[model samples]
Target chain A: MKLLESRGLLTLALAGAFLWSLTGVDWGSPLIHTGGGAAARTFFLALFPPDLSPDFLGVALAATWPTLAYAVAGMTVAVLIGIPLGILASGTVVSSPALRLPAALVSRFSLGGLRAIHELVWAVLFVAAFGLSPLAAVLALGLPYGGILGRIYAELLHDVPPEPLRALRTAGASPMRQFLYGRVPLALPDMISYTFYRFECAIRSAAIMSFVGIQGLGYQIQLSLHDLLFRQVWTLLLFMLLLVVLVDQWSSLVRRKLAA
Target chain B: MKVAAVTAPAATQLAAEGIAKSYPGVQALAPISFTVSPGERVALAGPSGSGKTTLLYLLAGLLQPDSGRLCIEGQDLTAMRPGKELARLVGMVHQQFDLVGSLPVVHNVLAGRLGQWSLASSAMSLIWPRERRLAQEALERLGIADKLNQRTSKLSGGEQQRVAIARLMVQSPRIILADEPVSSLDPALAEEMMRLLVELVEDSGKTLIASLHSPYLIKKYCSRVIGLRRGQVQFDLPAAELTEAVLDRLYDLKAERI
Candidate 1:
């Protein structure tokens, strides 16, 4: 009898919660959300109606340089900072209990904090600090990518064979020597593959940063959307998609070759 | 004993006095004393959990004994930095084979020289074609010269063991510590591996202390054998003196009287 009563009360609570959700829900908002297949449908209905607005395309082409530059620059700095810091963060490379624990803690928290904030949020902060320039995009991209790359690098460094390290140590190889010889070579392929993957992500991130007055393909997409020229927006979207696809293919091919 | 007359045992490659280790629930090794002389082929024969592994770890400087001293070449191992300096004198092969499976056979053999190489050069793989030649030589010595370019995973169990042996050959440490070096092989391959190990150690003028389960093989290859039971050295004697009575006692299995 008590079990039956409990089931009745549980059902009542769920019904109440469902009714409450009904009160605040705006279910229709999703129907018109930007790029929610509505604009996509409008875009395709125009069917090869090319938005070859030379003026707009010129602006996009001009912004393309900054987009490519920021992504490349950001990735280079991210990799440079990430690799060494990642090695330091990985206890396998340190092998000292006194320093390893604290270094690991710092690395985890710092990287976690960097990752918690989105690149858009970072761009806003950098724009405010540096006053709306290409530098803002670079800084915005660097932290998040560095955090990602560092975490991956640390994991790879830790996972490599300890046998080689032991062998090196026995041969009187220094800790640095052991890591360089034993750990780095094993981790190189994975790192390169992941970095290329990140480069793809950085391309998108660079475009997003342009909304804060920095210029890229994203800036063009945002402008086209604002003007309600859905056709032009599709072109920018196509370009971004093409870039992502190319980077994805390149990463896989490179990884395969490196593995070979 | 006058100062001029006092001469320590220079022939002794390793000496352990009162080495002990304990985990949370169990004592791994307890107050064990042992020694290995240069060119001596010794076997540590025991069942699982007999402290054979712990003893091997202590001798190889892979694990620190909670209490005791380990001396190699009259230099105190426990006194130096934990894995850093202790590794120089000891070459160890773990039971799992602990190989870099993706690496080529020659690269794995060349891994023995990682300790000898510098950080910059090691990263660059700048040890040159000569290093590869040396690795090839080591592989040749172990009769796997053709497998130099093949991935280590492509090799069979016995072949992998030979690759490991080749790595040890390149390491050229004063003492070689092998844990269950032939436990996974067939009887013939096991015998062959043991024979090769013995020959290599003898040729290099180094001491070998191998942990194993097979008493027959121990008797055949090793000059001396140490029997362990429940973290204690149950017996330490010449291989010829390891009688059936001792085996029965160590294994705790009674003989069937016909």
Candidate 2:
């Protein structure tokens, strides 16, 4: 009875809050602008017949490589940054009660600070500081991705079954040793799987950087969209979809092999 | 019975004085005092909520007691920093076996020596496991050398227990604690696991404190049996004197005997 009451209360509160939030926009005003409906409909129609021209295919193929390269390179840097920071933030590596909380908090705050900024904002900032360069795009993607990965890695490390770690503790493995033998090994599968999932997100984010003059799939997407060549846009979107599908298949394969 | 360990007995094995622990509202353990000597095979027997595991945790320094002192060889465990000395002094086997299921059997066994290894050697060993012989020998002794490279979780319950015992043997701490170590296995496998563990402990002459469900196994292996009820000691008797009458009271079994 108590459980149902609390659950019902929570549901009501959420519904009320959602309804309240809807008031922020004026419902009387038409949400779509003049001709917007036609544009949206045309965009949807183009999906059925994407451009198959040989030259556009070549452009998409070229764009695909750089997008893939940026994602891999950016994720490489993110993982490098994430693993070390994640270890520190996990509080598993720090045994001293005095330091563990503060250390975790600082690392968590740093991760939060990094992750708080959107990837697009980071790309703009990096471009402003370093000029329009591939390195800038990589850094922009890597920093936020690293923060997200580090926070998740820390959570994974913490989520490891305490019994194994406790057994290690009683066995007298030092803090660092306990983490290496106990926590890290247990969390590895989940951490790897999550990293791959995050890498998929990074692929899309890398493509998005094209708007900031970082040439990739998104740059081509922008140009195609601007020229109102919706068919060309569909072709680019198809290529992006193919990339995501490939990554999805590859990651699942890796997961299966590990599980096996 | 084993006379001495490879690592010689410290002057005292472990002594707890008025040690107690409780969660937020419930007192898990009342203040309790006891001492365990080197080479002693002790069994902790109790009903479901008897605080046997809690006592073992306090002894292992895995959990801090709300009050009182715990010492191993006169070194206060509560204050002791974890390092080589602590690593060499104590080891534990959990009900779950506490093996990292994803890791291979060999790595789990070699993890016993992570404290002894230099940071460099330990790191390198992760990639190029140096002490294969030690791990192999422990597994061979436990009759599971074939399982050395196998992922730990893939092994059956009985086999995983062997891996855990093999890891403990490699650890070779002077004091060993087991919390229902064989509870997860079948009757036959449990007996076999118990026998192997006893043989190893006997050979090394290390202190063994196991919390057990089976009175038969407890009487068969332990020299001293401590019975607990409601977070307090009911009896701390020699195994011979741990008669059926006491067992009935310990477990609150009204009319059953085994």
On DockQ, the candidate that comes out on top is 2
Best by lDDT: 2
What's the TM-score of chain A alone for every prediction?
Answer: 0.79, 0.91
lDDT of the candidates, in the order given = 0.78, 0.86
Per-residue lDDT of candidate 2, residues B1-258 (tens digit): 222332644445788899989998888899989988888889999988789988987877778899999988777887766656676778888898888888888888887887678777877887899889999999998788999898888998888888888888888988888888887778998898778878888998888999986878988888999988889988999987778889888888875644
lDDT of 2 by residue, A131-205 (tens): 988899899999999999999999999898888877766666777777888788889889999999998899999
**TM per prediction:** 0.82, 0.90
Compute the interface RMSD for each candidate structure. 3.5, 1.4
Q: Enumerate clash totals for all models, in the order shown.
A: 3, 0
Q: Considering just chain B, what TM-score does every model have? A: 0.90, 0.91
How high is the TM-score of chain B in model 2? 0.91
TM-score for predicted model 1 compared with the true structure: 0.82
Error of 2 at A255 (Å): 2.0
The CAPRI class of candidate 1 is acceptable
Worst 10 residues of 2 chain A by lDDT: A166-175
User: Model 1, B1-258: lDDT tens per residue?
Assistant: 011121555456678899999999999898988877777888998778999888887777667889988888777887865433555577877565666666678777776776665556566663353378888888888888999888777789888888888878877777788888787778988898789888888897778899976779888888899999999988999997888788877877774442
Candidate 1 C-alpha lDDT tens digits along A1-260: 99999999999999999999897878867746776787567767654764667876676667677888899999987897687778777876666679888888888777777778888899899999998877888989998888888888989988986765665555455677666656776788888988998999899889888678888888888887798887787667767787789889988998876666
Report each candidate's C-alpha RMSD, comma-separated, in the order given: 6.0, 3.6
Extract clashing residue pairs from model 2.
none
DockQ of each: 0.37, 0.61
